[model samples]
Target: MTDDTIKEVLKRIPYGFYAITSRSGDDVNAMVANWVMQTSFSPRQVALGLEKVSYTYGLIEKGGVFAINIFLKDGADALKPFMKGRSKNPDKMKDIQYSEGPETGSPILESAAAYLECRVVRIVDTGGDHDTVIGGVVAAGVSSPGEVGDTLSLPDLGWSYAG
Candidate 1:
């Protein structure tokens, strides 16, 4: 299949959207990402894909930990600033309102439906523009309990990776 066709096919695969947060001392960042997944269950593990150029990548590298916040459908609007790279401003997260998770200093949005705190176990070079950040799940919680009405994931909203 052609690369474009392959991308289109990949686009059809449903995935959830998450705000991956991390901090390195004073350097903190979050990215609106859809390419994350739970890869193992024995000890529990989740992986996130971060672009080499993203601010969140540096924070994850230095902090060695990260948090993933599963935003509610209405909460997705909060991601607009970060998606535009305006998260560089220290006060960017102020509007989101969050509480620190027990496992890390990374902010977990108070509005998120659930959260996962992870410690980096390994990072594999995806050999192109992004790095696959594999982290061991150290902590997790669901603030809003439900089998329905969480939020629409990337594919559910027909999102594509343009950045």
Candidate 2:
């Protein structure tokens, strides 16, 4: 297949957008992430693909915890500030309203449709642009009180993050 065809095919795969938060000491950061998946049903584990250079990755490595904030389909605009890499913008989480997850101490987005706090089980070198970090869910909850629409997805936002 042509390169463009491969990209289009990859884009066709359904993927949800999330605000992944990690903390180290007093530092906390959030980033727009699209490569996360539930890996195990028994233990309720999740695997997140994070670039090696990501500031949040560094925090997750050190803190051994993170939180996945599932955004609402109609709240994509609220997540725009976190779409930038924290390496370029150190204060990415500044002025954003969030609360510390009781289980992992990771920042949970106040406006997310749902939130999952996880404790890192391990990280594997993917030999790609991103490393695979596996985590076990410790706590989870729904942020919104009323009925919520579908979680935000790449196609819903007309965005592309993977090849």
Model 1, 62-95: lDDT tens digits are 8999998887766667677567553456566656
Pairs of colliding residues, candidate 1: none
Task: Estimate, for each residue in 92-148, the C-alpha lDDT of model 2 and write its tens digit.
Answer: 688899999998889988878899999999999979889999999999989774443
List TM-score per model, in order.
0.88, 0.93
* lDDT value, residue 18 of candidate 2: 92
RMSD of each: 2.3, 1.6
Inter-residue clash pairs, candidate 2: none
Q: TM-score for model 2?
A: 0.93
